[model samples]
Target: MIGMGSSRTQRPHTDRRDWDNLKSVLPFLLDFRSRAIFALSCLVLSKVATVGVPVMLKGIVDALEHKPEQVVVLPIALLLGYGLLRLLSAAFNELRDVVFARVRYRAMRRLSLRVLEHLHTQSLRFHLERKIGAISRDLERGTRSVSSLMNFMTFSIIPIMVEFLLVGIILLKEYPPIFALITFGTIAVYVWFTLRMADWRMDDRHTMNTLDSQANNQAIDSLVNYETVKYFNNEHLELARYDKTLNEWEGYAVKSQTSMSLLNFGQSAIIAVGVTIIMWVAANDVLQGQMSLGSLVMVNAFMLQLFIPLNSLGMIYRSLKYTLADMDTVFRLLDQQPEIQDLPHAPALKVAKGEIRFEQVEFGYQADRQILHGLTLTIPAGKTVAVVGQSGAGKSTLARLLYRFYDVTGGAIFIDGQDIRAVTQESLRRAIGIVPQDTVLFNETLRFNLQYGKPDATQADLEQAARMAHIAEFIAKLPDGWDTVVGERGLKLSGGEKQRVAIARAILKQPPILIFDEATSSLDSTTERAIQRTLEEVAGDHTTLIIAHRLSTIVNADQIVVLDAGRVVEQGTHPALLALKGHYAALWELQQREEQH
Candidate 1:
């Protein structure tokens, strides 16, 4: 796998960054267009009632000014109209919520699925660099923020803009043009200042999000390695580390609140000046009999409704910044190109006899540090081959390259005379099964984990695979049998038990080519002997690759290949290699001495 690029980086948003992030989600809105339109219509109707409230108040005030006899039923009518308007506003807003819930949920589901699919496409190295907690938090926060923005747009931003337009038109129609001018001008200044302040506070939002992901990663790491912490008596140290992250998050939150306080104060000050000027003019007009008393009341009510949402403009803008910061990470994850994608017209692999070959394969995880150097080897059809090498001799690289987790830098690998790169990755992987040295299980039921290999395997098939892997006896003795729950990463099971579960999974796959990467290294000698017999029986007439830790396990393999410094130093039957007294012979002798000690 190649190194990560800037496409994987989550830099903070700049101009139109929010819109750029949102573009990925535009499909959800379009898919549910009718619902979105209905919700938008509700918003408009609700605002109409909102703006109508002030007009109703003006009518009520005018009716009260009439002599009691002249306005018998008029005041009652005005009061009822005012009550209906308030109810209409509340009702329409609630209806909008109901209408848009589907769209919001669907958008979240689709976005989350895309991120998960993209993450799976990433190479193992990419995953090794990304902490599970941090990446999970990024996805969680991104999806949540995306859902929240819908509410921000419908309830806060769009409604506020609509109210502005309505209030401007009403003021121009009913009063002096200067009143409209002052109201619009004040709103414009409030929005501009709020935006500038929000942009300045974006740093705090980024810091908060970074701190949040760091804290989560620390917690996940500590908990996952709970045994290690206890063994070292580092409980206090772990707590201190977690507390430091919390303290940073607390500091950023405090700064955010303080900045919000200052912004709100400035917004209120601008609005107060605008309100005072407008009311002063209205009061003078009323005293001079140029405007009615109801007119003063109507203008005041308009100012109240307008300022209510305007006051929240700063908060909405701040939330927008936070949303962009959260989603930037998810978008960046999607932007990454898979290091080893199949060709556009790649076909499924056809494994006639599963003859595997590495012809002059050269590769490196990094450009400056090559691992495998011009290595070439072959496993004949229906034959078992053993690969033995010292650590860092590029043994594991062979398995990864065959799995197409990465493409070799030079040369090619072939199966049945067809280049592996010419085939689709999915089909190629499907034809091979591996039992790795480090077996990590999902936190699920034992039955579910076993079935993960072949979901359609019958109960009888599952039992046969388990028996062959030497795990059926242990599972049958359990209180819940196969239904027993395996804790996170199969922590409830011993290392040997987890390895057996992995063996059972691979056995269930029953692929034509099998790679046993120290498959029995974790098992006890008695169990290893029994499972080794079963493995030989299963390997009959199929290609097998074994990376052996205990040399005794591969003594009966059809052929043995010894690797040194990324090259094949020797290849022969066990007895022939023993006679040659080469690297294989020395390794066998060293292991024999260790066992004797």
Candidate 2:
């Protein structure tokens, strides 16, 4: 596909700018800054109480050591203090979780909404080229990563760092310099190993994500084309395709798990060796009358405090990295710029007479391959004009340009002499209603699909429109009536039923400018004639553009224009075109012969 405008520099996560990706989350979190600050404060208080537990236990030990007789008499104050510290630690941790819950979940909610709205703002080209399943997975994983990141930072990493600071201070103040050296040195080594392993494991994570998205995309695509698959009996072929991606994902997942096991074991060994060295030194100090048993107990308790959180550091670091990668994918989507943008402060389009004119328009989906070439046409105010042509004659392209799905490459289109480019897209679209050839309806209730054209339309308005489209009788006969659910893409309904629903929806909108691009092509001969009559009646006073393939259906149009090779070859009234015996006449004779048979 040819890029219509300047290409965007934004792409999916490719580099290791983890810090920049992390910064993208600040906007969502800033909304709850007060709550976030309270949560952090609670986290610090919890760690303070947790560290105090070891100190209180050391005090209780020393008090009992002062007298063996005191063994029978508990150190009541110290024991109570120890219990209170433990209680405070648990309470504050819970309080932190409670306070931060809104911040984390709200970030996820707001981010999801922003991504969705951004996708909507993108041009039709972007959606056409997107892989639904892969985008779906990205959206799911990205939103979830926000919660994971916040939870790990607020509850795990921050608290662990606080505890480490307290332990380092106590060790340096109360013990020999060698003790603090062993403790700090061991931490440095553990952190280094964990970060190194996490970086190595990141490759496996990225591979798994790619393979996983590919498999999901294939599965969804196959299911979406379920009828085609069944017709070709390609069940096994699809299975093999899905299995191939899954097999690769499985291999990497196993590798990731095995490597994680190794990292964990390495961490355990480092912690074990460090604790043994510290204990041996403390034991020697006590034996040499340089340290008391209480001092030894305090050192042991401090190691336990640090050891517990350090043990899980490897997994937390790996998960944090993975979450950052997920978040980057979403941020990349947010950065995508839409190809079609209205002028700054563009005004809404006013439809005074609804006269549309295509003034020497030129357009193409690709740069080298043009679809419409200098095509000029006009539909007078409150009149109907029909365009007829062979396939690929740019019949449908006219409707797309008029809808401003893509901007014209050369000349401009105008409504009531006002350039379309000068108007806001939403207002321009609102003034026009189109029933496309392929009428894909939402998988929703029949009433919902109709009301989509005018969300606040009343019941009488719906019934009147449905009746005009000749679909009301059919809907009334159904067991569920208007409440019937249209399956995905309206697959549950026949093609004719879907077309009728499309017509009803457009009629419900009742716009001044109406477009029926092959609108009746799906209906049977009887239904087609009936709906065609109704369409003629509905377009009696509206400025209507009818793009048709069947020549008979557009015989009564005020003017019929025949297109060939992206140019208007002939245009006149039905009798006048037949008299000219040109492209329109030849097409009429061809369709006439086909209809007779």
Winning candidate number (lDDT):
2
Show the lowest summed lDDT stretch of 10 residues, model 2: 1-10
Tens-digit lDDT track of model 2 for 1-597: 112243322223448567887888888789999999999998999999999988888878888887667765567878888999999999999999999999998998898999999998888889888888888999999999989999899988988999999988988888889999999899999999999988878878887887787778889988998998899998998887777778888988999999999999999999999999999999999999898888899889989988888898778888899998888888888888998899999999999999999999999999999999999999999999999999999999999889988999999999999899999999999999999999988999999999999999999999999999999999999999999999999999999999999999999999999999999988899999999899999999799999999888899999998999899999999999999998888888998899889
Off by over 4 Å in 1: 1-16
Q: lDDT for each of the candidates? A: 0.88, 0.90
Model 2 bad stretches (over 4 Å): 1-13, 69-74
Give the backbone clash total of model 2. Answer: 0
lDDT of 1 by residue, 439-484 (tens): 9999999999999999999999999999888899999999999999
